[model samples]
Target: MMLANVGTADRIIRIIIGLAIIAWSISAENLWWILGAVVLATGVFKFCGLYKVLGISTQGSTSK
Candidate 1:
């Protein structure tokens, strides 16, 4: 299983931004929703592939 690299605050922000983008996409009929979905997935999963690749972790050491 992949470790969580996203912190709580980061997750919350991503979720909010993702939802907003998705909402806008639904209203605008654009493809930006795909990006939103990706962002949402990262937030929901609490793991970011890019963060993994970059060796970054916003999660606190207590969780690890």
Candidate 2:
């Protein structure tokens, strides 16, 4: 698959955020699974709904 540049950045950011959330959740007795789901969805789809709704596109239409 010719994954877009946005995809890469999205995946990386999602994972980082997910890890942070999970860490905080673990320390605060919260749900880590929520963050896991967000990370999974973003990583699998390579598209972030929040990013889309905000009209943010990190990559060109074509993957380089």
Candidate 3:
């Protein structure tokens, strides 16, 4: 199963930041676009491999 480690607010912020990075990358025609794409993807999917590696999850638990 794909665990959703990103919360709604975090995802929204990521998407905004990612889009800004992408816009800058496009204007500069640099490799930063790749980073932006990855951020956007992680936001969209609500899963972050880095978060997994770091044992960090923004999602609230439902263990009740």
lDDT of 1: 0.96
lDDT by residue (tens digit), candidate 2, 1-64: 4333356766777777777777788788878868677876676567666666678777657734
Candidate 2, residue 58: Cα displacement in angstroms equals 1.7
Check candidate 2 and list the clashing pairs: none
- RMSD of every candidate to native, in Å, equals 1.2, 3.9, 1.3
Query: Which runs of model 1 end up more than 4 angstroms from their true locations?
Result: none
Off by over 4 Å in 3: none
TM-score of 2: 0.55
lDDT of 3 by residue, 1-64 (tens): 8889999998999999899999999999999999999999999999999999999999878586
Better of 1 and 2 by TM-score: 1
Error of 2 at 6 (Å): 3.7
List the candidate numbers ranked by lDDT, top first.
1, 3, 2
lDDT by residue (1-64, candidate 1, tens digit) is 9988999999999999999999999999999999999999999999999999999999989732
Off by over 4 Å in 2: 1-5, 32-36
